[model samples]
Target chain A: MSDLTAPGFPGEAVRLRARTGAAAAFPPAAEYGQVLFGAQCGTPGDQLDAMRLVPPVFMPQRLAKLIDLGREPLYQDVELGTVIGGFSSPLPVYVSALGSTRAAGGDLGLALSRQAGALGIPMVIGENVVPVNGYGRLDEDAGRSLLGRLRAYTEHLGDGPDGGVAVQQSTEDADAEVWNLVYSDPAARPLLDSGRLAFELKVGQGAKPGLGGMTVVDAEAAARMAGQYGLDPVFGEGRVLRSSSPGTFTAEILRQQIRLMRNNFPKARVWVKLIPGRDVAEAVRVAVEAGADAVTVDGAEGGTGWAPSAFTGQVGLPLAECLRRIGEKPPCLLVSGRIWEGGRAVKSLALGATAVGLGRAALLAVAEDQQDGLIRFVECLSMEMRLIVSALGKYAPGEISPDDVWSP
Target chain B: MIEDGPTQPGDPRAHLSSPATRSTLRIQNQLLAAAREYLTSAGFTEMLPPVIGPVTDPGGRGSKQVDIDFYGHRYKLMTSAILYKQASLLAFDKIFCIAPNVRLEPLETANTSRHLAEFHQLDVEVAGASREQIIQLVEDLVVHMVQRTIAALPEEFAALGRDVDAFADLVQGMFARTTHAEAVADLHAVGHDQSADAEIDWAGEALLSSKSSRPFFVTDYPKGSRGFYDRESRTEAGVLRNFDLIAPEGFGELCSGSERTNDYAEIITRMRETGENPQKYRWYLELVKEGIPASAGFGIGVERLTRYVAGLDAVWQANAFPKLPGVVSP
Candidate 1:
């Protein structure tokens, strides 16, 4: 540890830590987790933004399309439908893991779920929701609970075989047996029967690469969760900081965990979410080899409920670097960071991402208009994807290749 | 009905004269005769089932329905006669149908060793029967069918390499009864990962069936696992009064039956809950509203039973002309 008062040292973070004490380690996400993220604090070296989708002058796929259609082709001729991590999705995008943070847990969470369900895209409910909000309580307000989000998602889910839901479990959530509860809950029967449910193993998130989930809990809830979590009185009387341990895992542990998931929830799809670690490519290979249906890579630019701002900006590999590191055609490679627009999404797809995850952008969209904000946001992104793909002389999202993206 | 027309290339009739198929047909005929004998002796009236209807059972577990244009309206090929079995109870206390069904099961199921695109079912219904009554009825019917087939064609069993002792436990009343939750627990204990709230998945079902020496009834399936016609328990909020009769030695589910719901309000609510449009089920709902009797019934797949009894490798071996999920055959 270097001296904090060195004349040439970067002094802003240290000075802030001095003023706020232990509280400075985590971002002020309770006040601005859903809204202000990605606008100001983002990975400064995002290579996805550096790449451009360059269209060809000779459009043979479009010519083939013309012959197939017996006329000229348009951007609308592009089809976005794809299978994401074993779930049929109308678009090559999904609602990423939004957990039981204060800003995302209640009505807004339900609203986001409904929109995502109606859109016929898979939605991942993030970690620690069960431990924090109670699995579900009918006697009390259950709207913020994990079951509440599932019910909300299934309510507007369409008749087509498009959408599904994946429930994530952290170490604390594993203690609650979140997967077993959802696997047996009557509320999840529709998805289970239809083969649309999945269980996501939370290895780590992008925002905090090596740490567990962090949330600001009220004193009463803090006292209740004190046994399961590391509860620190960093925020004084009314508010406390709750920290969960990032569960230990080796390659073999990951392999067996996926095997256990497959054996325990045979009806449900198996998903493994990996952080933007230095060895992300190896982790992805290990997960895919162990029979994971989908392996999600959350880049350093990914958002979280609570994490240190330093980690958010500088802790892990950017999504583009992760994709480059993983190389070509890893099955069901789901990458997420600051994926808000079609340009970055198309670049990700070209760089070998099977699909892009909408995280903070989804939260912001839902917060903007709880009714149809996500729907509109997706509409714009999808339209842009179609236009870009069609211009590249391709008619499907999966047809995008590295040849189409120009790094310069 | 044998056809006299010119045989097309790759016709299934080419193999009809084979020894294996001949033995299979012999066992099938005996099973059919035994089913008719057993049901009629129990005071069940035999009725020809309608092959096309405005609405059919919507709980085929990921299977698609076949549709045809009937006059100006769209009609669906029967997946199961479960709905009409309830209506048939209006004229008779007990009824049975040698019914034909068509289901477009997922292409992946073609390798499951138990699925067929076209098949027949021995559909049976009894008025004023409880879930337990139906379970007992299915058990007895299965025992009788197996015993009759063995007695009628002992040499066929030997020729097909089917051991008569394989079904001894069934004939000796060794059929076990387990709840859906228990079955799921059993699968989980073996690392099968079966969902407790849904039907046992295909692999899990096979695992349980293989472990049993005798046929067993898995009862009290959760509400959403089956169609709305399966009655919900008044005592339990989400448990349905239903059961599936699984065959031994990994033959998988042989029969599925449940106590039928005749209350119009409950039927409508359940229909909506299961994602079925009530308007499409208008005729059935109207009949249900007119006070149909409380009944319990089940449909046992004839091909599946024949396959199990003959110890065949696949259900298609039991049929003269097989139609696998994605395969086109005569």
Candidate 2:
């Protein structure tokens, strides 16, 4: 091993193991592979900004929503609606997973899927978007493929029932099976007959947790991913990199890959995600005891496009210590990292998550306005999550729990 | 009900001299002469199909698939000659066609009064049949095309006033069935949560066809909600021996058969488990690997059965050059 040395580490790992000789065991952007990683200017130590939502001096669900709305209930009566991974989201925020890199793939991922489907929430769409954009072809022009961000998120997700999309996939989208082509797409049958679809799975993404997914391209897209991914030319002869792999699960192969994605995409909605590892709460208790329907996680201050700026400020664990090691009844739980405003999404919904995602702050609010900057940055994070859930006297966002947070 | 007809780029034959398009084309020619007198008196064999293909029917519901450029090889067009009614059941094992499909659909199903984007189907099949014999031959072909279009057009269903007692419980005997987990638990007992693994949502099939008054079906479904040519129900491990039918007072679905996947290694593992690309079904899996029979088909639509027997409130007023979906016309 290049003269192994373990004399009490750090000296910036011994002057980066003497300027990365033998690429000092990966990272340091494996010796600069045609760079791209963005957003990184100090902002790491997390634990949901050392918590604190704490309100209760007497609130009994705002006195049962002020005697069931016979009066006093403002903060727009809270209810930033929810249901994420099973869709119906009008709020508890979503948008996360933005893959195929080059700063949030194609048309800024269809203008963040047409303003997160006209602000109804839920988005995802990450991983190598159908092996780099092309699971489209319904006689062409479904640009930015993955059925053009599922037809710009179900044609501006109008006919209510909140929003939804999900997608994800990875491991080179299971050799382009990308959830069996978005579960047998007919442009994903109106989001699988209106359950608004979902699929997710991925396994590890916060910046670069346990690696896989690297992007960089251009050697004519790494010679069209010559023999499917893991390209490398050490990002040189006209920039290449590519890569993918990080797949290899265990908890019974992640419970038989969520029972073969519920016996092969039984009308989608499965989810999963995970990464801020250190057994991110036993992989969210084995993907919600193998049935998933939303799990996410991310954390290591998530945000990527091409990592190794020391796995974007030191790899994994942070979205408030993966929601304090996924505690407090995490069933749907989501969470992300560097979440944009609404005080870290109502302090990751007062610490038991169930929502908060908006990754790289929804690609920097649709790169600052691609038709209403992520709808006025989610209408200023849904009016700062209804004035922080009606100033913690709560009215909805599932009545903000963990005794409305407060850590040391 | 059959009113629409004015495209004025110089009124191309103003809806063929309307009188409500001549009583909706005389009740769609006795609903295509009672579907060719009930599939040639039940023996079948009609055929005409192939309106350009190399592959069509990639299982719709969201539609899109017009393509053409044929001489240069990109074909397509017929969005439902359901694989040429399963390769014309190997030249004959009971067939039927009336095909002509186009499909670009979704423009939010152009105001959903039953979409069109150019249509027509009636498409049957048979060979060795059985998904309970094509759901009893599509409920005796929709009660022999509504008793032969009400005895050869009762004055075009009384000049389209239509209401032959809405086919009293569908010409009596057998029409109501359900199972797609009891129409998704009767659309989650009226709250309409539908999706018992999908295929029911045009507003939950118009809320289970406006709580049915006749004509039903629904059946199995679930194996990833269709099109690896349906099949997959060897004693139900995810169901799907197919079905749909619908059409009651709400006038929705009107047929969508199944029980197909004719073996060639389960049609190449149901075309790679429904993501298709079995090399774009090379000549229909080389004629289902040199064989093609195990049928049990269905198609229906024909302007949604002439807009539910000419009671026409939409399906483009039961056609005559309808098209609709994203509009634009000739």
Compare the candidates by TM-score and give the number of the best one: 1
lDDT of 1 by residue, B1-330 (tens): 112312221356666887878998999999999999999998999999999997787644556677577885658899888888889888899999999998776555677778888999999999999999888889888899888889989999888888898887889875899999999888889898765656788889989988999999999987656777899999997788999999888889999999988899888777644434465577888888889999999999999999888888788878888888767677
Q: Top DockQ: which candidate number?
A: 2
Candidate 1 chain A: minimum summed lDDT over ten consecutive residues — where? Answer: A1-10
Q: Candidate 1, A129: how far from true, in Å? A: 0.6
Whole-structure CA lDDT of model 1: 0.82
Candidate 1 lDDT over A325-367, as tens digits, reads 9996898999888777778899999999889998876776676
Backbone clash pairs for candidate 1 read A264-B193
Candidate 2, after superposition: displacement of residue A155 in Å?
37
- Give the TM-score (vs. native) of candidate 2: 0.32
Instruction: Candidate 2: give the TM-score of chain A.
Output: 0.36
* Residue ranges of candidate 2 with Cα displaced over 4 Å: A1-126, A129-198, A201-214, A218-236, A240-267, A270-300, A303-331, A338-350, A354-408, B1-245, B248-252, B255-330
